[model samples]
Target chain A: MDSRVLRTRRDVLTAAMDELVEGGWDAVTHARVAGRAGYAKATLYAHWPDRLALVRDAFDQVGRMPHHEPTGDLRADLVGELVSFRTAMTEHRLDRALAVLAERAGPVPELVEVRRRFVEDGERPMRLLLAPVLSGARLEAATAMLCGAVVHATLLHGAPPTDEEVEAAVDLVLVGVTGA
Target chain B: MDSRVLRTRRDVLTAAMDELVEGGWDAVTHARVAGRAGYAKATLYAHWPDRLALVRDAFDQVGRMPHHEPTGDLRADLVGELVSFRTAMTEHRLDRALAVLAERAGPVPELVEVRRRFVEDGERPMRLLLAPVLSGARLEAATAMLCGAVVHATLLHGAPPTDEEVEAAVDLVLVGVTGA
Candidate 1:
């Protein structure tokens, strides 16, 4: 790749994500990303048009969490997905990416779609893990409880929940799902 | 209140909140707020220094939720608080105020303090409601799960949970507390 103008649209978008990962949504500004991508600000704006647009593109590559192998233990599998969720939130700086949408007054629909996809992708593994044991509204509540626990913990604590916290949270949901 | 300069500090702060409530954080820009407060941008900037500072002051007055008269029933009390919470989030425009801090790459210390107070204020009733029935890690876990559910539902749906949804959530938690 040449130092001058020598890349495709993918390169610019990748650079936007690189900035987001390194710094956060604030880091995806026109000046920094354009310089990093070796594209003129004019060209970058021509495509993404704004910081939110660039950030939208960046989120496309997000929410692909690592696969959690189910050990055939319902409790363990549930905990596994949640711990993985916490890990992903922290390690990937998703807390900040989420902040991008979480701060809107009226959510921008396109951005909301990005958040929806990220959520659906994150929950897919959990859905698969819980389907056999839990179904319908119970499963929905459980998912909300577990996922909401992680989010609320972060909101309150300014960081992700600890592994023990995640375990305890999952246990709270377990009785709800498995009790007589 | 005079048309020109006939108010107290309370009026300005109130106006800032008015903007936050009506248009969210984005609407609290220097020009709009300064104009609304009947103060010049210089005056607003002198006090606030920046958008975040003004927002910081606005949040100081936030988090006073209405009293939920607790019935003797723990389940009803719990559901009452969660329902009140959902209502507050929708009515007070707390969702957008929260987004001001939520979108940050890092949680602002001062704003986080505001959020802390808000959470504590919101949860005080719940703490009192549950103290008789729960304590230690169980209490902590339950608090996180319930609050997290509200936050997660808002994030996923872009609106606060309906009253029925809040009731369903309390049931999910109640089962955990009262086992088979």
Candidate 2:
């Protein structure tokens, strides 16, 4: 793509994300995004035909998990995973976007797939770190417990888990699952 | 209230729930519900006055926790709680409804309070059952872990946790928290 076209695409996507973060799914429309990006509606339509397409593109740009190298320390590794999860969910407003997509009627199939992929990819590293300690059904159960604690703490409290809370959750899972 | 009036109210609420389950929040307008309930639109207005009122009444009727008597056997009680959580969330379609409500713009204050009340009330019993073994922040953390597992498992798998998954989670929490 030409440099100018690339710049325009980036600008429009950023505007769409801004709309999403400001007012959620309903607020991101082609016209609104075009207005935010200082482009004609026709220009937006020429690139991404619909609201779903723009939102999905914005998600692709912003949705990412933080990397945390395991230190071969089970408790510390688990805390690292929890912190990374919280960072990814809150920083990119993934939780808010997901809450919207879940409520949407007949959500675009690729968008749903995108979320599932994010979850699976996010868990892959943690699963690897803990594999020696747990496997099969046991590993799955442990993953659910730890991840759920982090996610639900955010949902119920509207904030990421404090360091103490994260450590406590990691401790419960580590001691409970591995007898460590 | 007169028996006939009570029946009419029940019918209207049932119709409202059907609209919600079938078409979501936007579909529960007074006109549509009144039409479905075989009442004049004015009747619905007289009873509900608005969409939020209708939704709140329907939730009050359908949003109830399944009663599970704790057996004083900690693992078993926890599993029972998980099962009850799944049943209530899925059967009443409360989880879907809640995901929508959570994403809704400026949600009705009363409806949000209704959900908060449900979550808190549901936790009270499990708190009592686990109090002997855990309390304070530990108890709260444990509750979040178990509840999050059930809820997130449903969110990811699009199905409730199986019996084995439930047992594994309960076992982990029991052993992890209590050193059993």
Clashing pairs in 1: A103-B99
The sequence of per-residue lDDT tens digits that candidate 1 reaches over residues B46-119 is 77888777777776666466757898988888887887777777776666666555554264455677666666
Chain A TM-score, prediction 1: 0.79
Stretches of candidate 2 off by over 4 Å are A67-69, A105-110, A156-160, B105-111
Q: Write the per-residue lDDT of candidate 1 for residues A1-180, one digit (tens) a residue.
A: 555433556778778877875665567898899899887899988877898888777777554767578898878888888887777778866666666667542545566777777777777888787677676666666667778888877755576777776777777677766773
DockQ, prediction 1? 0.50
Q: Is the docking of candidate 1 incorrect, acceptable, medium or high quality?
A: medium
User: Which residue runs of candidate 1 sit more than 4 Å off their true CA positions?
Assistant: A1-11, A18-27, A40-53, A105-107, B1-7, B21-31, B39-53, B105-107
Interface RMSD of each: 2.5, 2.7
Candidate 2 lDDT over A64-168, as tens digits, reads: 557577898877888887888787768866566555555553234555665666567667887887788887667877788788776666554355577777777
**Candidate 2 local Cα displacement, residue B65, angstroms:** 2.6
Model 2's CAPRI class is medium
Chain A TM-score of each model, in the order shown?
0.79, 0.83
